[model samples]
Target: MKKVSCIFIVDDDPITVFGIKKMLKSVASCDDIQIFQNGHEAHEAIKERLKEGKIIPEVVFLDINMPIMDGWEFLDELIALDIKEHITINMITSSIDPLDYKKWNGFKNRCPYTLNFKNKPIFKIEANDLGCMDIAS
Candidate 1:
């Protein structure tokens, strides 16, 4: 599998972020890892990077519920930006609501880049299964 260059974890929960980061560090060979507490911050930073012609993350782990902007809103803004790079997005949330799943499925249909829906507290196995690990290793 291709090695991921950069990754972004966009979630409000500090504990979740820490756990995900730890898991990724153990399993993946990504070069850069960025953390954002909310979608608004992530969105602004991404836009700034785009404007500056800087490297954007190849993968994004986004949570559904946040203070400034929610995951769905983030997706809307992201798609509207028309970013040229192919960034895979995984919806990582604790929401077990059927409606959330439905919405995520709908978003996946609309945006092919949205890869999978993962629950909170991502595991090493799941990360590896998602092709996030270094296959050459």
Candidate 2:
């Protein structure tokens, strides 16, 4: 399997983005990770990259509960732009509300690029966590 290079993380907190990038580096999962303090910046950056014919991120870590442009708002804008055909978006939130889970589930179906959902403050990326399945017969 080919290793992914580009990573785009969107969140309102700078510290959170720093922590996520640090953790990913600690695990050596990726060498290049882009950080955006807000969804508006992330969206604009992604759009520019798309126009430049650059490959989008294989993994996106999104945080909910942001100002001006929350995760869902960003998702809507992303869908409207239609530049995430090959990208996988993973919701990384701290909320434990059942409704949040339900919304993500529904969004996964409604959105074209949403791949999965998970809580934020992640420290590791397990093979199983990335949706790798074993097939034996």
Candidate 3:
């Protein structure tokens, strides 16, 4: 598999962000790894990039729960935009609620390019739930 050039980590937790970043670095070769503290920031950046006719991130590791614009909200707004290219949206979250899966499935239906969401129990050197090598590759 080919490596991703650009990746976006959209999460509010600093610890989670750091863990993901480290895992990605160890497992794959990504030239640009951008971090967004919340979905709103990530959403804005995506829109800006689209407007400027710049290349969007190839992959997005999104967290479900967040303040000032959750993952669902971001996806809702995103689907409205004219994004023709494919983007692998990985909903990396700790929540195991049934509703989360249900909601995610709906988004999956709407988003043809998005991958199934992953609920990670832990992020570490030995990847399991955070399949950085597979995802990045």
- lDDT by candidate, in order shown: 0.81, 0.74, 0.78
TM-score of 3: 0.84
Model 1 scores worst on lDDT over the 10 consecutive residues at 125-134
Off by over 4 Å in 3: 122-137
Better of 1 and 2 by TM-score: 1
Best by lDDT: 1
Tell me the tens digit of each residue's lDDT in model 1 across 1-137: 34678888999889988887787766667778899999999999899999998898888888999998999999989998988777878888888999999998888888846467887656652544334445534
lDDT of 3 by residue, 10-115 (tens): 9999998888887777666778889998889998999898889888887888898999999999888878875887777788889979999999888888775656
Reference-based TM-score of each model = 0.87, 0.81, 0.84
Model 2 per-residue lDDT at 112: 74
Evaluated at residue 109, the lDDT of candidate 3 is 85
Worst 10-residue lDDT window for candidate 3 reads 124-133
Candidate 1: residue 81 Cα off by (Å):
0.9
Q: Judged by TM-score, which candidate is best?
A: 1
User: What TM-score does model 2 achieve against the real structure?
Assistant: 0.81
Return the lDDT, model 1, position 41. Answer: 92
